[model samples]
Target: MRYAKSADGARIAYSAGGAGEPLLLLAGQGNTHHWWDGVLDDFRAAHRTITLDYRGTGDSDRPDEPYSTEGFAEDAIAVLDDLGVERAHVYGTSMGGRVAQWLAARRPDRVRALVLGCTSPGGPNAVDRGDDVRRSLARPAPEGRRRALLELMYTPGWLATHPGPYRTLGDPTMTPKERLRHLVASERHDAWDALPGIQAPTLVVHGDDDLLNPTANAALLAERVPGARLCLIPGARHAYFEESRSVAGPLVLDFLREHERA
Candidate 1:
């Protein structure tokens, strides 16, 4: 694991693999760099993929205080700076997508393109997962919580094909507290009005059956961002990356490639 010092001087943990145009991956809340395990190979095939564990999650330094989405964005920028990457395609999922949007809006020149998956603009229409979902997320990882999370994240067909490293759910390494903090940060984020400010070429991908962020959020993003394309994966759910990597991977790679060529 490598480290980058954020503006706030917090050391962020990240890993770089593959070799090609730089592609920084910002993971969703509660997730660490390992969360991208499902799609890493595909991304690595075409780009130098950098996967990071956000502050207070995974192996990154966790500061005791209120976490802000803006802080996550700064951490991303710090990672890029540490790697000497002036500009690169930025792809984020879920909460990570929120951070990516902020990064593109605030540091337009540093972002070559944007790919938002299963995320929202934090607008009025943003879907909330309800108290049950929130309670489930907040409580300790019960025996079936991981599977339940997988169900909410992906469609049944997806779960059938790729069962995932399910054993990890019970692994001692999982951090429930950090995950709860991530949920808190996500609930507080409100970037709806800032969508138009993102200048980078953007692609919004969502699952038609996504109950977490809802498919409408993707529509909101496409509608707000001029020329931003939207792709709705049929029957997929919030965790589209794990659910339909064959589909999501190609679509993401294609977008990055198209922009790189232009």
Candidate 2:
């Protein structure tokens, strides 16, 4: 893993692998770089894939300061700058997508292409998960909470075969305060105004049945961003990038390849 110092002197932890044009992989809310372990190989096959542990997760430092998607985008920029990468393709899911919006808007020169999966524009314009879904996730038992999240994330058929650890759910390592901070960061994301200013070629991908980030948000994102394409994976849910990787993966790769800098 490599380290980058953010504008606020926060130590951002990031790693890079494979070979080809640089491709940044941003994770979902409250997750570490390992969240992409399943799809990383696919991305790595044709790109110099990079992943990072957001503040309060994995190896990144957890300072008690306020967290925001904009700040996280700066952290991503720090990682790129540390590696001397001037520009690259960006793929972010969930809260990561929120950060990517800021990255592409705030630093247009640093993004070659952009992909947002199962994410929202946040604030009042975005459709949120239902209150019942949120209440179910707040269940007392850790196992139950994880189960609830997994059920919401993937279909029962997928879950039946792929039992055991998935990195997207709550991490035992995160303190209550750290978890709340991450949630706050995700909740406070409001990229509505910034979407139209993004200059990079953009793709908005989502699962048709996503309960965590409703599929409707995908259309909203596609509409908000200038000339952005939208892809909806059938029979998939929140974790479509993983559950339907066979379909979503290649689509994203083809899109990125099409927009590769010459």
Model 1: runs farther than 4 Å from truth?
A: 123-125, 130-141, 166-176
lDDT of 2 by residue, 1-262 (tens): 8899998888999999999999999998888999998889999999999999998888899998778899899999999999899999999999999999999999999999999999999999999899999998999998898888999899999999998578777556888898889899999999999999999999999999998888899999999999999999999998888889899999999999999877
Supply the TM-score for candidate 2: 0.98
> Where in model 2 is the C-alpha error above 4 Å?
none
- The worst-scoring run of ten residues by lDDT in candidate 2 lies at 163-172
* CA lDDT scores, all candidates in order: 0.82, 0.92
Q: Which candidate has the highest lDDT of all?
A: 2
lDDT of 1 by residue, 1-262 (tens): 9999998889999988899999999877777887788678999999999988888877889887678788899999999888998899999988889999889888999999999989988846576666777666555656566666767876676568865664113223546676666767887888878888889999999989887777888998898877899999988888777667788999999999998834
Estimate candidate 1's RMSD in Å. 2.4
Which residue pairs in candidate 2 have backbone atoms (N, alpha carbon, C) closer than 3 angstroms, thus clashing? Answer: none
